[model samples]
Target: MSDTITLLYAQSVIWLVVFGLCAVIALMFRRVRAFYRRIAPLGALAPTAATIAHLPTTFLRSFSGSEVTAGGSREDGRPQLLVFVSGSCPVSRKMVPIVDDFARRERLSLLYCGDESDEAQKRTIATLGLSESGFVNDAAIGRLLGVDRVPFAVLLDPTGTVQARGLVNNLEHLESLLGVQETGYRSLQGFMTANPRALTG
Candidate 1:
């Protein structure tokens, strides 16, 4: 009986040591992955958004089905921010106020994009109080921009150049578009490539 108890105790200690080692390894691995993600190019981690360098030259339609000439210098000479959303998406609905606030704060001309039906789009426009000048309910724009997901955003300079474009689910993501613009790089990957010091910083 004494020998059996000692063996059981030893086995338990061995298992505990193994579990502890695994926990330490998991923690270290997570830290390393996080560090890598910070240093890696923006799109390299998990594709949060497409790397569209410039706004494709194309004509866009408003939610009211009116022709709107896009891809040229803005009349107001301010940057434009296009947010892709779906009227049916709960997250999109949640983002309406946040996006509005961000656009107003950033001095950006905010535009909303979606691929929902016209009736649904109309309802969404009315429900959200979106300006006709700032609403687009077309799939063509999403195709042109290579947007594979909803809740994506593209920031354009006054000259119609893409300053930054990415998937924005929260304020941090929305704000990163501005941060990317400040770096003077059209994309975060380009910024990291040119500014290697950012890794350590």
Candidate 2:
């Protein structure tokens, strides 16, 4: 009986040690993941609104002279994509093309919020060859939207209901926000192919 008790105690100690090692490994992996995400510009993961829960609001005192054209006469239609960004944010700069493509293909309304100078704004517009049809800027809009950071995007339906909102750092997150299920935004071709039929009245 004494020998049996000793064996059981040794087994328990071994399991405790194993569990401790696993916990430490998990912690190490989490830190490594965070490090990689920061440097890699995770254009693949979909971040939730909760991630920006601590983000600050815009501090601009005045609005730009540039006007943002509100699109669609329809009382009910596709969601509005509001992107808050600045010329300095690397993530926002990278997502410019993604937003442009979404606007063109989906024929959705898009609004960009920031306190950009007139010359810089004009250059950005020209560089992107953006359609004046749907683009707009209002720094105050960020305050109303509770935005304080760059590279932020929000999705709102025609009824002004927020559908999905988050940081536009990755294609996956954008895809999910746009209501792309399954493989989400990663499967852009499949989405475009199936979207028309899904929306047909």
Q: Pick the candidate with the highest lDDT.
A: 1
Alpha-carbon TM-score of each model against the true structure: 0.66, 0.49
Compared with the true structure, what per-residue lDDT tens digits does model 2 show for residues 77-181? Answer: 655677776666767778888887776676766776665676676665565554444345565555555566767777655645555555677666576666632
Whole-model alpha-carbon lDDT for candidate 1: 0.75
- TM-score of candidate 2 to 2 decimals: 0.49
Residue-level error in angstroms, candidate 1, position 157: 0.4
After superposing candidate 1, which stretches have Cα over 4 Å from the reference?
1-52, 126-129, 189-201
Task: Give the alpha-carbon lDDT of every model.
Answer: 0.75, 0.58
Residue clash pairs of candidate 2:
43-170, 43-171, 46-173, 56-148, 68-136
Give candidate 2's error at residue 97 in angstroms: 1.6
**TM-score result, candidate 1:** 0.66
Which candidate ranks first by TM-score, i.e. highest? 1
